[model samples]
Target: MIILHNYFHTFPEFPPECEFKYAPENVSRFTEAMLSGNLRIIILSLFSFLGHYGVSIFVFVSGYGLSKCYDHSGESKWYIILRRAIQLWKWLVPMALLLILDRYSGYTHFTYAYLGNNKIWTDMLFMLTFTANGLADRFIIAGPWWYFGMAFLLYVIYALFLRKSSDKVLWGIIAGVWTLLIVLSSLGLDNWVFAFRYNSIGWLPVFCVGILLSRHPVYISWRWISLGVVLFVLSLFNRYLWVVSPILALFPVAAVLPLARKEPLQNVLLFMGKLSAALFVTHAFVRQQVLAHDQALPPEISGLLYLLLCIVVAWVYRLCLTCFYKKIHL
Candidate 1:
């Protein structure tokens, strides 16, 4: 077993010397062009196409990081899981409260008259109970809340497996779950209402791959990365392999990790990683409000604006939380 001490640092970081500092000489025409709002919108829109894979990547990273940090220091597995859940809850609770306020204050329309009983209340219960992903329908308000539920479930699975199972056993279990999900999807059970269509069952294998990587941090060769690229291109034409596309994308990313040790890249990546949860929870609401108010705005521009607004709002929310905590201490 390769035990890496301080393996999973809290946030992605690089050597201090590699940090981001503006250099006048390094400013290029492309960089200047990126400063323009319209150009930025176009560029961001292109990147946004990759957004569907974000949650899958997050689960993979979480599994890898948690596994790397796992210690056999005699602490109870339940205690570790609870601690992580509390940490996650600290961020989630604030967003949940804001959503509730929006729902009740007529700022957001969560209820549809067509649905006889209020589904919003059911959504709220699911959100609070960390089971929101069980609601497979996309019409519900706060649709992104499903990620939290799915992630929470994955965390519990990771904790349990890490505590009790051997690496081979864990791999076998992940393979079993993956095969079952594929079988169900093949039988058109993905459309079944009672089934956990949006659940982590489909994602567990990806997460397990991450855990395996943590145990054996193999250097991904250029050949593998090239193969991954080919697979990704092939996936575009073959819809059946779409589920594993994120895993293929991750191969190139893993290969590039070493090159990204520079400070500027690290800073940007760290900021995004830190605010990812907040942005995920808040972006849908921001998008809805923006589109509702400005129906004429192009979808690309609206998406760019939504992203910028989410970053600013999430930053302010974190600032407010810091102040509140400071006041409590006083």
Candidate 2:
């Protein structure tokens, strides 16, 4: 779904006026599609819906896994925070070096694509350390790296508050936080990309759903699936709710629970799951090379080639990562 946007969202046939429309405003492709009356854009916008939901599911699953493992006990809060921080930066440090090298060497243009100013290092340190993503979006060396900042923010929230809360207190906290968010969003906070897509507070509702489910495991029956579909459909009706479609989009993953026991399909699923973060972290670099240099290739063929290249690169990335860590003995 995300690859649909990454590889195939070039609406090259747009009228001249709309060619570079969304760039100045920092609006997303989804918003561009929503506002554009072009039929092709509207149809392709479904990919936006499905693709962005991946982050929501990722956060939710992170919350679930944390709750299941810790259950509000064990490690000290700072220890948990330190551990998560290491995990985030271990990837960022190497990836940042690769990006800087790419920028200086590629065209020898001395122009950094997303690295912008040298302040990226400072920005990343503060962002990754604190996950104060409101300021952290400026550290947009890789566009998707915003999620790492947000993920750490969520982790901090988990370590500091969530790990100690009772179920009732947790639900109340979720409601209270969202109520504040709704009011702030009504006052136009959603216009900021950070608040709209990268804020831990905005993401908390979905994450809390995972925590609750982990605390009280539920059966994934057809009725629950039906309810999930219904709520997801309803979320599309309202603008604010529509922003959280990821939460609603999460229900369908339950339908795939049975796949864990299947044959090659299970192996495929596990492989992708293990490599998903590596794929996301590295794909933008691969994409820059793929899309920029795929000269005059057919769109369908180029798209497939790009996808294949991403998986291959991600596998290599995984191997390199494991070897590096083993060498360091961390």
Candidate achieving the largest lDDT = 2
For each candidate, the alpha-carbon lDDT, in order, equals 0.58, 0.67
C-alpha positional error of residue 30 in candidate 1 after TM-score superposition, expressed in Å: 27
- State TM-scores per candidate: 0.76, 0.81
Clashing pairs in 2: none
lDDT of 1 by residue, 1-330 (tens): 000101111012201100011112222322333455565433442243334555657778988887877734466778877877876687777766765555566533532221233565676677767777666655354555567777888888877765455789768866686566556546656454124436766677778888888887887678888888888655433434544565676865666787678889889878877777666666665655565665586554555565677678777877787687688872
List runs of model 1 lying over 4 Å from the truth.
1-49, 106-117, 192-197, 255-259
Error of 2 at 279 (Å): 1.2
Please report, as a residue range, the 10-residue window in candidate 1 with the lowest summed lDDT: 1-10
RMSD of each: 11.6, 4.9
